[model samples]
Target chain A: MDDQQKWRLELQNSNVEIRATAAENLCLAGSDSVAAAVDLVVACGDVEDVQNWAAAALEDIGAPPVDSVDALESLVSSSDPLVSYWAVTLLGRLGVDASRSQVILGKAVSDSPHPSVQERAAWALGKIGATEASVVESLKKAAASDSPRLANLASRALA
Target chain B: MFWLIVALLTGGGVSGLLNPDWPIVGPLVTSVKTQAIEYKNQNPLGLVGGDAGHESANTAGAYAGPPVQSASALGPNDKILMATFNIQVFGESKLRKPEAMAVIVEVIRKFDVIAIQEVRAKADDILPRLIAELNADGSRYDFIIGPRLGRSVSKEQYAFVYDTNRIELDSASVGTIGDPADLLHRAPFIARFRPRTTDPDRAFTFWLVNTHTDPDDVPEEVNALAQVFQVMQTARPDEDDVILLGDLNANEQQLGDIRKIPGVQWVVGGGVMTNTRQNKAYDNIIFCAPATQEFTGKWNVLNFEQEFNLSREEALRVSDHFPVWAEFDVWESSGAVH
Candidate 1:
């Protein structure tokens, strides 16, 4: 098997360390295959370390397959802050190409319990540069957030 | 039969003793070996500055501390400046840019000894190359690097680069604190140093624990670093001054349990932003104020954008984090006001 195939297999391994290592290797390898992206998204649910590497791998993959957007959008609602944070990070990296995630990204900005995830979602909205009324409304509400950092990022996104 | 199986399991059976390569455990053995190889690859200390006579002071074993010597009168106004900088992702890309390297080198030249973090590279020549650039003007500088560390494949190494003419390294006293519990993402690199002074007896000798805590795991890592500080305090029986400095990823108020350490004080206090963004305060230089009486009450974050007259874009290219520094008397203060 090629290296990507081997790493894809390792991503599904029961061992968290093995999965983490595989995600890391996949990132370093710079493989942007949809198959690898799917495997990494699945690995995101494993552990914090695994989620970090997997998120990094997705970001490194940059311009992931449009088909992968659904998986990423679904992950934004995850209860795990880190999981949703990484998911929003990758979506933001997708730029205007991830337009379909605008609604979910907006909801995450206003409704996500975690401030970090909300911050990233706001940043992602800015990257998306959406002018839709709903996105602007969510960012406006976030602009007055009690968290200064979050409010600042939301204001910037609106800008 | 039971005895034979137990012996085999314990590696005392005839076949196990003779071959030592039992097939049953081969997969587990291979995994262990792979992990070891990965660690060695990430470390790359053996490959650092190869054949260039670029020495990294990482000698093994515990330090016996400085020998007792006669006290001598310290010269007036003798002092040194020390700093900690997280030059975000210092690697080949950053090195190739002469403008950025010059800005970075200029920031480093401002201090006598600077602890650097985020030295991310598969190759080991980055630090040596940086030293070469710093000394292009005939300044004598050297560096000591710790093993690269991280939970991800994107590992980072910590380095203490010092101007040899202004500072002297205790060559035998360099190591990374052992973190067997996997608490810190990157264990702090530690070393001891004293000013290059005529009065060796009175030179202010101190240990520096350089670290960069994971931003995602700040609370736990900062808490664990408290233990690291406690360990370094006692690591050298003869040493009383231990200065822990690095990109802590948290401000003074958020330092967690480390702030609970008695007499612990930090240089880059609250309301100071260390990042180029001028937003978050994520770095500091901490020490026991009572023990390290050498501090001269002077410290500040070096804003390269303002100092170098670079635009915000230009500054960000140089580093996401700016250098934070503190000045100290060259001789042991011993509670002396001067």
Candidate 2:
């Protein structure tokens, strides 16, 4: 099998070490490695340890995986906090072009059960820099939230 | 580990260990190796220009006695140095890097008081270790750390480390802001301090509100800070001199509502960058003007890279943020105090 197929197989392996190793190796592949990016998005949905390594790999990639935006968008709602955290952060890292995900990010900011998830969603919205009225209203609502973490993030985004 | 030892031996001895260009030895090992190197370099004789360099010597003919009238001519005892530093995450990540601690200690020793931020809840050992290190030279240094605070589950503590000989802490006045409005992520901690001085005319007390605002929440937090400031003032009705210092995370222009607070002066200004990366002015020392005229106009952003002769990355490994400081005379003055 090719390097991509080898990594993909490792990602699917039952052993956590094998999956983590594959994710880390894929991260080392850097931003141009679309294959690594694709596999990392798949791994982002895996168990927490595997998911963390995969998300870190995606972060190391430092650019949005053009092919993985849809997958990331879906992962933003994952029950796992780590998965949602990485997904929102990744979306933010994608910048203004990822504006299409603003609605979901705004909802995550307002209603996500986890404080970290809400914080990241607010950060992602700020990163997207959407000036739309709905986006502003959502941030305003979040800015007034009782949680200082969420409020601070929403205030920053609005600023 | 072997390569790190070799690098330390060949590159300027102990100081070279903090060189950012040193080959990556993985994050965990790097912290361990850096600490081991610093431990090896520790000297009892006191290395050249350690604490001694900070001393101010009077000119041969100048008056050396107390009650030095001019603020410019004030000696170290007649002046108090204060600093604000975001030591990144001062926990296990920094614990193993003794070289960084050495730099941190050296920077802090130059000041009478320092407000430190980003102290992790899990790493309570770091402060005791730091205090022990600072007191090793027979200097009496103590710290008051606030409870673990943050809006999120992940939390950090704020602390004030001061030289006992130069300042006295009002134990009763120590408390964190109770944010009923829920405006700030981490409510600032207020500590009242009275400068130790024999000259009763010069004795003055001030409240220090140590804070580390979230970068994302600068506008709102900065605005809300005015409320925190007002509450602190109300708590200590007699003290009008209140100084806000820490990683404000906002520049002067971005101060939002904080800028509107009348008579407030941001001492560190002109777009000076305080981060090791040289991109942001994330730290500040702001005080209520006219009330705090003891300010000596001397301010600095301690650049660890330039001071330690280390590479930028090495400095960052110590801390991404640099310490910003301002000097103040122990004596209160009326017009044009330095």
Candidate 3:
């Protein structure tokens, strides 16, 4: 119907390049295209390439959609580490403004199976600066993690 | 009245003013000394090894051992203690561990000035709580916390906390390095401090460039740190004493670009591991040996596990990294004792 709607359709297209191009175009649209990019990322499901591209587009957008925090939170809790990584990274970029996602990020710090996902989650929690007792406890556990990378990241967040 | 006049006439007035035992000055000096002694007694270093009123009663099993001296007690009178600690994310998580907090306080109390790294953005409550705990025993301390810094989405803050009675921060001299090339992930934070000693001749000042390099970008940031140190040294030609301290994330063998600087010395060398895990020498207290002539050659890692009698797991909970410290004389120039 409109240019943004046209790009959203391309995002659903079976073509990989088309989806990437659509994601890039949405990024170029900046803050105006946040809702569509968020929708693309959420609806794209387990499509790693499309989700990754859309996540990067959201990162480029630089601002979180006011209503998209729930979708991003759901994405962060994804069992897939890549999806969790990209989503948590995007939340980190959003900073304290994404306060609603702090608890899930804190949980992911200690619970996430992948080190990178756990690291990103710890980083996001630090960015959020959440003061909850549970959040602090989760980070403390992660700080003593056997994995040096995860421990270092958790330590940085605790520091 | 006659004695007072005679005392004033013979330049005794000046001597009397400086004398700690003089009737007018005696009470104030005694009061300060009393306070220091009281603080030391209340928060004894050996308290960590005992069943004190610590919050970690359940988790931290009782420590039974001889009272070991604190790192602060080992320094010579003429020298001030300076330390750099990578406090592992120093935020809400650390606050949640009260046993860890107690051990941290004991280690920190051993230094007059400490440069803290990895302060998370938005965790402003940690420092105030620490200061409150430190001052509960009557020790006065103040801090200079910098703005959020880093090259990533998750930024951090650098802070300098000093004993107000021993050191005075040069408020105007606090700033972070500006990296136009973006070589460093987090620009080093610089601050100047003067020893709060009455002997003007012995009162000296120095600059501290505090930093924590990205682990992945250690080699480049380490080299860039040398450049930053050089620039900071030249920026303040009047102040020859400059110390760079933090979690370099690289040992002496890996200090690629930093070792190239002339007169530079790594006080904490590769032989010493400054981490609680005993795996890495991530923290360091570095300075130009020739320029900082006041170095007393006294330094050590604050091993909480051994010193505080903490279990390996409990110790790691405090911080995977240990504090590394060095002692430096208060005098800027070599001179006969007054």
Candidate 4:
């Protein structure tokens, strides 16, 4: 594969230091390695100690293309809190098509079992500026609930 | 008669032009006052209690039993609000974010302490404007800014604001809990607050930690969580308590690799919450000292979607996430600080 792929593989490999190096490199590798980026995140969630590289990899991927929205969406629905949390946030950072995305984002925010995933989805909706009725009501309920993070996301989104 | 009338008009016009006060002044002052009132009504500082339309209907503020029975009362009764939020930095360029920040502050006012993440450096408009407005409004938020670990130009990335009236901050700093450059972990922002000003140590002292973990973020999050827990476990007095909060980005479903971290307890009855567009919860607050019955703190996800002027069609126009809040006993003790 390409240098980007090579580095992405390194991020998913067994070596922690290599993974860190891969994260730094992937950040510079740009969009081609977006899969590697997502993979790194999923993989990092499983690593113990301090795998700062995984976070770096995801942040490096930054906003991805629309093609990957489905994959990200699937992860967003993950029962695993780690995968779900990062997926929601990444989709939020990358997914901005409010018209097409409102439903996708709405579903993720409303369905995720983890409050953080839900919170990030709500935030992504706000970031995309999805003022749809369903999104609003979901956010309203989350905000009114006992979760401060949800409340913050809801109020800010509406604001 | 025409000349005479012209002369009369000229005299009146000349006299009005020469004088500072004119017929327009009366109406102008009235308009200014009206505008001021309108501004205040819509202002976040004034409307924090959710005076907005439909959204207000669902807001706790709508039926709140006076959050404060006694503004400065004792322990169990003297509850204060503490919160943390990420004010998504207002885009790239821009140096002013008064309105953008007002959204956050208006919601933030109900709380006594707030820890903010992603507060962009001085170049960004939101942070400075936020500080200015809060200060101008006589806000007593004593500040402690977090460091910018990354190379990006964004200034102090993390920050803390605590109401001076409720807490006395002894010292604050950005901790490098798991600072390995390869791991891209931004240091955690920490501040110690004394609930009772008189005796700093004996009073309700707790650590308020604010952090934004790296997206598919570092293993550091687990380490950071563990370290904070350790600090609280060892340092905290039996009488005092610990409050830890931020966007953890991790949850129970995480594999044992992540779950192996020590002392980080998943808050019971606290799980990935829904009720938003994409239902999930990433943000969290963990208290380890067995939250005193007096300090039954939980999340307050403000459901602003149900309370705004925006309609169903325009709903997506607002933000995607919700603001999480919680009420806590600032001072845990009974006889003394309560």
Residues B1-338, candidate 1, lDDT per residue (tens digit)? 22122223433232112112222121111110011222224334442223232332222121111222222122233888999998866777578779989999988988889999988776767887888888788666767777878754457889899876667665445567666445677888877787766665577889898999966557868998898887766554467788999999899889998999999999887588988878778889999888888999999999999998999768867876899999998898775321
User: Lowest summed-lDDT stretch of 10 residues in model 2 chain A?
Assistant: A26-35
Q: After superposition, how far is residue A88 of candidate 4 from its true place, in Å?
A: 20
Interface RMSD of each: 10.9, 6.6, 14.0, 15.2
How would the docking of model 3 be graded? incorrect
- Model 4 misplacement above 4 A: A1-159, B1-77, B90-98, B122-126, B151-156, B172-184, B196-202, B218-220, B235-240, B255-276, B289-294, B307-320, B334-338
lDDT of 1 by residue, A72-147 (tens): 8988898766568767877887788898788899999989988778877987887788677898899999999887
Per-residue error at B90 for model 4, in Å?
4.9
Query: Whose TM-score is higher: candidate 2's or candidate 4's?
Result: 2
Task: Give the per-residue lDDT of model 4 (tens digit) for A51-74.
Answer: 333443455466766666677666
RMSD of each: 15.8, 14.5, 19.9, 23.9
In order, the Cα lDDT scores of the candidates are: 0.71, 0.67, 0.65, 0.49
Model 2 lDDT tens row, B1-338: 22223334433323111222233232111111122232223222332113431222121111111221223212376788888998865765456678878898877787788999988635445576777788788665666677777654446778888876576554434556666545676888767665666653346667798999865457778887876665544443356777899988787778776677778888777878988878788799987777788888888999989999988656866776899988887766654321
DockQ of each: 0.04, 0.13, 0.03, 0.03
Model 4 C-alpha lDDT versus the unseen true structure? 0.49
Highest lDDT model number: 1
Where does the lowest 10-residue lDDT sum fall in candidate 3 chain B? B27-36
**Residue A65 CA displacement from its true place in model 4, Å:** 5.6
**What RMSD does model 1 have?**
15.8
Error of 4 at B174 (Å): 6.4
